[model samples]
Target: MRRKRAAGEPQWFFRRLVAIGVIGFAAWRLMMLESAPDTRVNETIAWGWILLMATVVLGYLGFASAQDIVAIFATRSGTPYAALDDPTDPPERPSEPPRNFAG
Candidate 1:
């Protein structure tokens, strides 16, 4: 019998590389800053602002992820009716049938 590669190897490797790249880049930047001849306080302040922005972005992503989880739970847990599920307006007419007739 032939052996097959693990299905998740590529995805797992990519995730690991991304994680390492992020850490290594951050470390390299920090090290370069430490050796800089001139350090502007504004540059440090910019880094702080960037960190704050990153936090806000991460928070937004967290909220969206939570919303998705809630939607899944609502579907499984009950009738799945809520203000969020309410449509703001009628849906538009379909551009075409959802299924293809020529298939």
Candidate 2:
């Protein structure tokens, strides 16, 4: 039995499917070019694949960096609750004064 997908699972699955399709198409095209007589065509295809992969990697990195920046700013804009002391839990004070070290 197939389990039900979560809220965003469908979108995730669709993205994976599209990625797989693109990679498969590229691989197929490359394989088809293998029998071509011209070496330039093969090199071009190889270079295109390399560029495409690089672009994808760079794009992912850029997205992650942007997310990090947003998260940092979000945290900075929020009030720091840790610094605030709770009224219910009052701080303890020393009852006696400190004695001289010489004594």
Candidate 3:
């Protein structure tokens, strides 16, 4: 019934951000040092970049981002898969009592 924050989202995503940032910075540095012809578009560079991106995706499979997607049915009236354990409570909302309670 409530929106949930995925587990380890911050830490996992930050790690990915740092990894990408480091790689991107290194690429920029290499670009600055290596001069290229303004006219010639290098197929090798394009192919290598595609291969690098695919490798990154494959690596992410091993370092999968965690999300608490399980659902638990305590009464056992639901599907077996639904019995999987996960957090039951929603994150507490910021406290600010309603200014008006008009019924």
Candidate that scores best on lDDT:
2
lDDT for each residue of candidate 1 in 1-103, tens digit (9 for 90 to 100): 9444432212235545655565566656666666666557747854865575566557655765666578658567433333244577998986975886795
Candidate 3 weakest lDDT stretch, 10 residues: 65-74
Question: Which 10 residues in a row give candidate 1 its minimum summed lDDT?
Answer: 3-12
TM-score of each: 0.34, 0.44, 0.32
Which is the winner by lDDT between candidate 2 and candidate 3? 2
Please tell me which model should have the higher lDDT, number 1 or number 2. Answer: 2
Model 2 C-alpha lDDT per residue in residues 26-94, reported as the tens digit of each score: 777778777877787678887797677557556655765666566557667343222444499678886
Point out the worst 10-residue segment of candidate 2 by lDDT.
Answer: 77-86
Top candidate by TM-score: 2
User: So what's the TM-score on candidate 2?
Assistant: 0.44
Clashes of 2: 0
lDDT of each: 0.57, 0.61, 0.53
